[model samples]
Target: MTRPVGYYVHHQGAGHWQRAVAVARALETLGRPCTLMGTLAGLDTAAAPGPVLDLPDDRLDAGFDGRDGAAERPECLHYAPLGHPGIRARMGRIAAWAAQHDPALMIVDVSAEVALLARLLSVPSLVVRLSGTRTDRPHLEAFRAASRLLAPFPEALDGGAVPDWVRAKTLYGGFLGTAPATAATDEDGRIVVVFGRGGEGGALGPLVQAAAAVPGRDWHVLGPVSGTGAIPANLHLHGWVAEVRPHLASAALVVGGAGDGLVTAVAALGRRFLCLPEPRAYAEQEAKADALERLGAAIVHRGWPDAPAWPGLVARGLALDPGIVRSLAEPDALARTAAAIEAMCREAG
Candidate 1:
């Protein structure tokens, strides 16, 4: 029997699952049977590259009666609330699945506790790299325990924050997304505003007002606009777009959070972009935006958008180096990464 590869997709948002799916597809192409386990709601395995295992929701793993934050066992991990059945069940499910399947390789995408669990289970594990300030004890412990660390972004985008020892065990796999059919050419002058879930804390109100102020431009808003009570006539609000590639492909300017999905999409399309990073657990979006800004790939606006400053930001975004942005479009990153993982599995088997 062919040994399977397992993936643990974090349920924080769609981005984690999306990345796992891309990698899983690549692994399937490499003739590896893959299984994805996650706590994400409404997970449809029909489109998955291989079998799917649905784990109990970890977010619901809070038994704290009126406690403000999550309950943790100790200083080594985070967010595993005490006496939370969901958390216990989720961890039990993962441990049980690993034991029954005996997967050759386990990929955590990512959680410190899961990576640690994989190592403790005697399974060689790869922990997916995350951006932001990750110097905490839990993060370091997880990274140390993993067999290898896979960073989904290009090596060029690496910020010097990762300790040398951790960097030694890491592999930079460029931006991993479902590669577009063909490289999308630059769009016309239509502007597309994508405010991902993180945008809830952003300046959506000002962004809409700014788009309205900029006349003679078509603006399409994608995803929820948190504070904007009324939709403007000039802007078409699309709650959620199933396939955002075409809109991104034809966009003149793409405004969105610095999440992996939006940034990678814009990079692939070679669109001029302004990154509005929202607060995250470890400054994830902020760090990514900073890197892109340093590369001249994106215009990072740290402050909330105001109508008065909108025009200038747009101008700055336009002036950014298109070549730099386009360089981030790694069409073959997933393929290379999958091939590497397959090789690792083969060696382990």
Candidate 2:
């Protein structure tokens, strides 16, 4: 009997779950069963291709404040708080599922502790590699523990920063997401400002100022915006839309953070991107922005540019070659990722 594959998705951001769903669908096409495991709160579990294992939330809350101080936690672990029932229950549930299913492989996208747990359980695991400087003890140990590393980006995005061994172990699956079926005509002088839920989005004041600076252009904001002053006539706020692709498709220039989902969508749509990478753990977005700028795929600004700088930045972004951005997307990325997972499952069996 062919054993099912288990995928542990991180609930922090939408990108992880989106990638998992895409990969799971591809796996279904390959006649391989997959089970998604994660905290189901706020996620669309119905989109999952196979069985869903909703794990207990392990994050620190007022009732379950078990987080350790920075200096007190183990060097090999990123977050292992003590006396958290949720964490304990979450791990126990995972272990129980693993024992019951005896899955051929465990795909972690991604958690160091869970990867280590898979190793302890004698299960072959594939860890989804994200873009960033992940040489810390915890990340390195998890990488070592993983049977293989799956990079959901083109290898060129690595920028040759990682060690030779890590590159060798990783299979670059390319960017995984659906591109727009048909290119929507770009709305001339329309600048779309996008934000992902993973990080604190762009400040409303800066955005308004930026929009006011370019009075001729129509500015549209997607996702949450904090801080409110006076709303500009040219600036429009559409908080957290269900479909960003349509808005992105119509953009003369896409301005957003360097998260995978936004980047993937922008790249696939061949949109001229102005990247304003938000602060994130391990400088993930910063590193991604660096890679994108280096690759000539985006016009990256370190922070929200001053009001006077917006006009020049907007011109630069609009002038970027769309083909260069499109090159970052692999049309067959989802299929390729699924194939890689299938191969890993076969090897494990």
Candidate 3:
């Protein structure tokens, strides 16, 4: 009998779920049954290749935060709030699922606690590693517990900071997302600005100023934004769109944070990128931006530059080499990731 593989998708960002679906579909093609488990509220799970398990939300109630149970949290754990029924229920559900399925492998999109839990349950887990300085106790322990680590970007972007042991235990799956198709020609010299849901949206004031500064190029803003004042004639706000690929494909240059999803998409599409990395936990985006700039794949800035600086920045972004960015997109990444998981499952059996 072919034992099923279990994937625990993190609910914080769309990237986790996006990668999960892509990987699950690849696994299906390989004849490896897989199940995805996560807090599925507001997510479109219709395209998932296998059964979906919606887990309970483990966040604390309103008015309470992570600091509430900071002292009680174990040295090796990051988030474990006490007296939360949701947390208890969430872990209980995952434990129950493991007991029922006896899964050959558990793939954790990212959660130190959950990876540790799988280890406790005697299920070998493969953890999806994210970029950043993740050398803390909880992260190190989780990496050690994992049977293997999966880095979704090319190995060159790692910056060679991780310990020798982690590098040895990892499988570098370069950019696991939808491969880019031939992009439409950008006759209008459009500049597309994107903001992801994982963090605060872009500020409209700076965007307006930028658009006004660069009068020749039209700026199309996607996703949410804060602040409202005068709207620039050249700055068109579309808010959140159902699809961003069309806008991205027709853009002369792209501006956004250094998130895994946006970066992967830009790389795959061979678009020029102006990375304004937003602040994130463990300085994830900052670290990624550093690697991108170092590799000549993007033009990075610390923060939103003044209106006077926008013209030069825009020119620099447009001048970047699309071929360098496209090189980071491994066309066979999804297949390689799925094959690695299958091999690990076979070894376990």
* lDDT for each residue of candidate 1 in 161-261, tens digit (9 for 90 to 100): 88998889998888887776456765677788886643453345775687777866788878766565675667777776655777787777888888888
Model 1 alpha-carbon drift over 4 Å, by segment: 60-72, 181-183, 198-207, 226-232
Index of the highest-TM-score prediction: 3
Question: Which is the winner by TM-score between candidate 1 and candidate 3?
Answer: 3
Q: Mind giving the per-residue lDDT tens digits that candidate 2 earns over 33-142?
A: 99999887987788888999999988887453334555587777988978879989999999999999899999999899999999999999999889888889989999
Model 2 steric clash pairs: none
Clashes (candidate 2): 0
Q: Ranking under TM-score, best-scoring first?
A: 3, 2, 1
Q: Using lDDT as the measure, name the better of candidate 2 and candidate 3.
A: 3
lDDT of 2 at 124: 98
Rank the candidate models, highest lDDT first: 3, 2, 1
Please name the candidate that would achieve the greatest lDDT relative to the true structure. 3
Model 3 C-alpha lDDT per residue in residues 97-204, reported as the tens digit of each score: 999998999999889999999999999999998999988999999999999999988998995679999999999999998655446465368999998877678888
TM-score, every prediction: 0.93, 0.94, 0.95
Model 3 lDDT on a 0 to 1 scale: 0.88
**After superposition, which runs of candidate 3 have C-alpha atoms over 4 Å from their true positions?**
62-68, 181-187
**Candidate 2, which segments miss by more than 4 Å at Cα?**
62-67, 70-73, 181-184, 227-230
For model 1, what is the error of residue 120's alpha carbon versus the real structure, in angstroms, after optimal superposition? Answer: 1.3
Global lDDT of each model? 0.81, 0.87, 0.88
